[model samples]
Target: MSVTSSDPRIAGARAAPKRGIRFSWSDPLFRAIIWQIVIVGIVVGIGWYLVHNTMQNLAARRIATGFDFLDRVAGIPIGESMIAYDSSVHTYGRALVIGVLNTLQVSVVGIILATIIGTLVGIGRLSSNWLLARLTAFYVEVIRDIPLLLQLLFWYTMLQGLPPPRQAWSIGDTAFLSNRGIKLPLLEWQTAYGFALLGLAAGIAATIWWSRRASRVQEQTGVRPSVWPVAIGGMVVLPLAIWALFGAPLVLDIPALRGFNFQGGGTISPEFSALLIGLVTYTAGFIAEIVRSGIQAVPNGQWEAARALGLRHGVILRQIILPQALRVIIPPMTSQYLNLTKNSSLAVAIGFQDIVSIANTTLNQTGQAIEVIAIIMAVYLTISLSISLFMNWYNARIALVER
Candidate 1:
């Protein structure tokens, strides 16, 4: 006998492995994979068929489909745009670019304002003062109940009802509010401003680096270095120094009445004003609820434990509560962000001329409805995916790790 092994596992392990597909319904993993592949194939096939059929019908009807329309001159009159755009000079592409910028301009600012307002309202909802809590609750209820479209219309009408430029409400003679919209002093921009901005950006980057280093040092030494000094120097002092170095240009272009309207200054159009006010007010209501719920979702024990540590109320809330609460808050917050961006499309109703408004104009003028629709879908999908990815990454980063 040559050390005969009776164990089935050892014998099987020593045996040559079987090769080739074993088509058995009892093999769960294999069957599941096979079914998934089959389903995916069917979906792909159906999609291809639909696309092919659509193309055939379009061609038969002589409906041209391509992005070539983007090259055509866009004679569409845009009231306001971020970039240099003229109906007589620019192509459809440039007009669309302007629309995108306008949309981003509204969306980015709306998101920031909404987040700040919502967070405050959410905290206020749990305030010790009965009046503050009740007031915040009232705000959330009333704002959420009313339709956003109606709000937009109300704001637009209100702005339009303002007095003419000649008799406009003056803010210390530096700004004016009129039916033409709010006119403010425009910065006479210079190279020095750009250098100051660059210094600010660099400062921010340096602050971040120093913060990370401090965090690592704290982990190793159990003594946390304060990051505020660096933050202030980087964010404030550095920019001021750069600006002073470049002669500290602080020129302004004050608006003056020109015939029927104000000129020579920055103007916030009524359309944009209405849209931003509507979006921020409407979205902040929902976001407030999300924030409130997320905060409440934390166990009472967490609060008690934080208090036991003798940490200040602000520090405990910021360092202990929020980190845990974010897990609940972020997923819903991402949805609200997407909603705000998509809702910006409603700007068309108020003549804000966001991306959707521009694309609609493009389709009507070019007779390339398909292309324009595709562009719209692609833009929204890209933005939504980007928000989702960032939120998901952040959520995973702050997630509690198991030992």
Candidate 2:
């Protein structure tokens, strides 16, 4: 060996690789960072040019901009709104809020229904019964093949072809289905009921916590606590107790036949009905596939192992396989949920006044296309982000931890 430097400073300097970034193209990290900065700068420059050009053009046309228009009278008629909307009274802002509510209403209900139906069908597809499996498979294949917009049109057409309000289908005058929509007695909501609903929500959270705690107890002591009693108490008893504490106000706003349409109760407009039906069915097909794949991803050895422990098929699925399969199921299910929410924008096609539909109307009425489109994008972004965050948290919660 050649004489080596024993001085600490000299030895350290000799051993250490070169410090600071080299400007040479041969340095991969330096090259990557430089190219990235250059690309970013170019994109920023282009964006600035486009925005500046558009502003100049708008100014030349003397077209007023910004959201000052939201406070002005909307004067836009909205057929179906969750909240009160008077075209002569409300502003564009209120109209947009109504559109968001309608979109959220359908999206929330559709997600719940789709998840339930999808999970059931997915499990059915894996059943030992040949007919059941084949039927589920047929549904998945057919639905996945058809375009969602076409399906929406089909459902809307079917609903539109129903009898008019005057000759509508009815059940003892309490409920009616017609070309107008589904008319049902609205449950008169009370403050007490709202409190009870809050209690129910709290109970659900408690139930989840208790289940996790039970799992930990089982893992540590080889004895799982009975969870059903706690589940029933928290979910059912707690809500009922809260309701009772508030005197349990129960009132129904019954619908009455008046003129061409029903009054005094809720009406699920044909557009709303068709949109909800189409979304639930279409989304269920995709969710079914996701669930099936998640279940299949679990190894067959898991089933045999559970059986060896003298467990029933249903118990094995619920207690063992599914908990593991969730690691696979949750990620894709999140994408489906996001898709359903975004696709709800297609509500405009059939006249359901979702955000996109109302936004388009607002665009025409206000002649502020930029502001209107921005509002639409912002609403979708907020909703999609909320869904993603919740799903990501759940995925993390269920992820396998190395011991």
The top-ranked prediction according to TM-score is 1
lDDT of 2: 0.91
- Residue 396 C-alpha lDDT in model 1: 79
Measured over all alpha carbons after superposition, the RMSD of each candidate to the real structure, in angstroms, is 6.2, 6.1
TM-score of 1: 0.85
Model-by-model lDDT, in order?
0.89, 0.91
Model 1 C-alpha RMSD to native: 6.2
| Off by more than 4 A, model 2 | 1-37, 189-251, 400-403
lDDT of 2 by residue, 1-403 (tens): 2337587766654443466567788665577689999999999999999999999999999997999989989998889887888999999999999989998999999999999999999999999999999999999999989999999999999999999888989999789888999899999979988888898898889889999999999999999998888889888999999999988888999888798678888888899889999999999999999999999999999999999999999999999988988888999999999999999999999999999999899999889999899899999999999999999998988884411
Decoy 2 TM-score against native: 0.83
Candidate 1, pairs of clashing residues: none
